[model samples]
Target: MINKQYSITQAPNYWYDIMRGVEQGYSIKLTRNSEVVAMLVPAQYEQPPKQNFWQALEIFRQQVNIAELYDENVFSDVRDRCPGREVLL
Candidate 1:
């Protein structure tokens, strides 16, 4: 990850540019009085990894019964729908 630093005084004026950089995948370091205080990154970077289909099913099964969790007919109508592309990995 790219790292960029800015002081508290400079941060307010350049906040938007810093956020845009973060959106483009940079990690920003914000400082106060020349001392590092905080770091900013995209939400996805802080989120936990997503479970695969089977793992998610298992978790749901543990919380509820298989009858409630399983739905074979749920995606029946999705075959004709358009599948969106992945934007980020």
Candidate 2:
């Protein structure tokens, strides 16, 4: 990657130029008082690790609350039981 450095004060003025460089695979280092404060580089896409069926299920179980999932009382009054008016067609 092409590497470039700029002082904090100079970054704002060169923001668009720096971004264009970064888009073209340049690595930009922003310095403050001669110390490196930040870096802007081309983003990399990585695939997350795959989980097997049982492992995925275990994760799902850990995140869910069993009592909340099975709470009948919470939903008892939610549905409207009345029949709707009949349509012509």
Candidate 3:
């Protein structure tokens, strides 16, 4: 490969070609005012999946709310045993 500097154009076709080069073997650096800001790595390193605060909350939300809180068979029996009380589940 030649030591020719390349410019990242704002064209879709050019972007596609750049992505292909990146996939093959290329270094893409995002600079702001000639200062390096970020980059698109040629390949991603192996890392554990990340879970943000909301994502962790969502994962916890999917867990069972209560074991016998709303069991259909036991619900009616519990209701009969305790009447005039609000069944909030």
RMSD of 1: 14.2
TM for candidate 2 is 0.49
Reference-based lDDT, residue 88, model 3? 88
lDDT of 1 by residue, 18-89 (tens): 999899888899999888899988777878889999999999878987676788999998696767787886
Pairs that collide, model 1: none
> For every model shown, what is its TM-score relative to the native structure?
0.55, 0.49, 0.33
Tell me which of candidates 2 and 3 scores higher on lDDT: 2
Tens-digit per-residue lDDT, 1-89, candidate 2: 64899999999999999999888878999999999999898875235788999999999999997877786687789998889889898
TM-score of 1: 0.55
Candidate 1 Cα misplacement greater than 4 A, ranges:
49-57, 60-89
Model 3 / residue 46 / CA error / Å: 3.7
Global lDDT of each model? 0.87, 0.87, 0.58
User: Weakest 10 consecutive residues, lDDT, candidate 3?
Assistant: 2-11
lDDT of 2: 0.87
